[model samples]
Target: MRVERLVPLALPRGQKLQCELCRGPAGLRCGACCVTYYCEVEHQKADWDSIHEKICQLLIPLRTPLPFYNSDKERNHGLEQQLSREKHLVELTHRVAQKFLFEGKHKEAIPAALHSLRFSIHIYGLNSVELVPPYLILAEASIGLGHLTQAEEYLSQAQWTVLKTSHCSDAIQSKLHRNLGLLYAAKGNFEESLYHLANDIYFASCAFGTNNISSSGGYYHMANVFFRQNKMDIADSLYSEATDIWHSYFSGLIDVQLQTIMSPSEIDILCLPALRFHSMELNTIFIPSADESQQAEASQILNAILDIREHASRQQPMKTGKVVHALAMLHYLILDIPKAHELAMKALLIISYLQKQDSAEAIQQLINLIKSKPFYAK
Candidate 1:
């Protein structure tokens, strides 16, 4: 719930504020853009040659009044073309915002995103779907910067806008609820957090059933609420569901991790894996059984599944590590020590990598679970 501070530029190691020029320090402000920054004036000036020149060009519209864009059909045509060209510029702003978010530069991201959103609105119009993400981004940035009331207000506006026409996409809804849940949870409003989380979970479940990444995210956050409540049984169940969904969701997307820029329904998705790993230390692992013959048969089938999973993990689009993790858990439950060890190690590697690189709570949870391997330690 506590949003960490943004890392400074020129720092040895940190999150979003890395200097673009040196990739060490945080940005301060560009005299031209008046928004982007550098560790120092020198870096800002040096970067002007490569990055800042283009960014300055992108800022041209922002500097001009809104009336110019609407100056007439011919001018509008030129403005429209210019806006189209700057589409990528907006993307760059979002990327910069992401770095800020990662480095706990939440405050910076809000303003940066605000600037970009304003430009986006001028180009795409306020009602355009393009504006939705920036609104959501600012809302989340507000949450990170401990501006919960502002966060809620921004999110509410975005939700109303999206729902005005069609129900917002499951992805957006999942995020909306997830953001609300995080804000409420941070405020110690567990009941409100739970309410939003529950809705998120339901949506995530539907998404999961249909193999939708958004819905699976819902289940993940749902598990978190349960975990916080110390309802281990329910939490574990939801965790299992979430792990499976994450595995499935990311199965086809290699090295493309689900970012921790979470929504209301997604905290649990990220947290559930971590919780499950914690639960493993209690010596309460479950294994399916029928008979000796059936166990062997099931183990054979599991091996086949494991092979498919491994193959998938190797491919670019299908990162099957989660599948490997679940399989490893199942292998352990079935008392297949060798298989469990292998798959567990594989899962541990993937989860560890994700945690290290992305700082996802779910992966961290899995790593903790691996570290507390009482059964395997001996």
Candidate 2:
């Protein structure tokens, strides 16, 4: 019997990602996933003869031109054509994005993920389990690009989306929390990371059973976080536990059912972006009259956005400081005088790091906007 899938294939390691068999420095890769490498045609052919042929047809390509779904009049119902288009668009787009991400081409992956995010929201809606995979992929890609705050938002959305569906298994829930833990760790918030990691361990244990080898992955990560925090005793114990689990599995009591499944990022096609708003409608705000509560709510939203901008300044100071400063003016316009002053101060803090003249001008203009207010007349 042949292997039923071409994916989840592991590549041999070298200075570069290497050939599966020869272990030679290689460049030519399998077109399907762009992962498997070959030193020469002979080695490639040999590998295929040995194992690849069994699973080749089951493999999804890393990237491909978008597939057009044909729905002529005979098969076209009101929504049939629309669903067909959405399915092909989302699936193919996801594949392309995953390819970029796997290759560590983070800059290239970002746009692909952004495009898929929009498609996921439209195709799966807010409540579907289908939304979790792309949301997690977008989060991972965002993390790769050092967009920690964007990653946090994506993780939150993933959690919310998962909660909206009862179909998600404990393993998936564990996976989501694991990413959250990792995200918080990246942001230098180890407390949140440990909490999430612990939850991941718990859920994974529940899903895979206490003695299953697959549950050790969660133990390994949790140990890793503890190791990072310099809690040697705890880390040592967790590491030992993971080792014991693996040793037991190597002794041949492993459960095939407990192995991790291929996530959506691994197998699906890409997603096409869906337009959320009309260009004209976005430019026009309909809230002409605001009550006191509305004003307070708006100020709260501005505050959260300000926090994101401040964090963003660390990565893209010139661009973010300008936006933060402008948002400060908006804060003042909304009569949130204190918040506006804080936002202005935060932007100015970033300005000390910016080397651009235009960025300085934008910050100055933001200052002028705040100072022109009667409250700042002194």
Which candidate number would show the highest lDDT if scored against the true structure? Answer: 2
| Count of backbone collisions within predicted model 1 | 24
What's the lDDT of the predicted structure labeled candidate 1?
0.56
The runs of at least 3 residues in candidate 1 whose Cα sits more than 4 Å from the true structure, single-residue gaps closed, are 1-57, 60-77, 95-108, 124-130, 163-168, 201-209, 250-378
lDDT of 1 by residue, 237-320 (tens): 565555555454333221222222234454454354443444443353232222322233233333443453455323421234
- Score every model by TM-score: 0.49, 0.41
Q: Write the per-residue lDDT of candidate 2 for residues 131-237, one digit (tens) a residue.
A: 77677777877887889988888888889878777778987788798788878888878899889888888888899888565456566667777878878677656
lDDT over C-alpha atoms for residue 172 of model 2: 78
lDDT of 2: 0.57
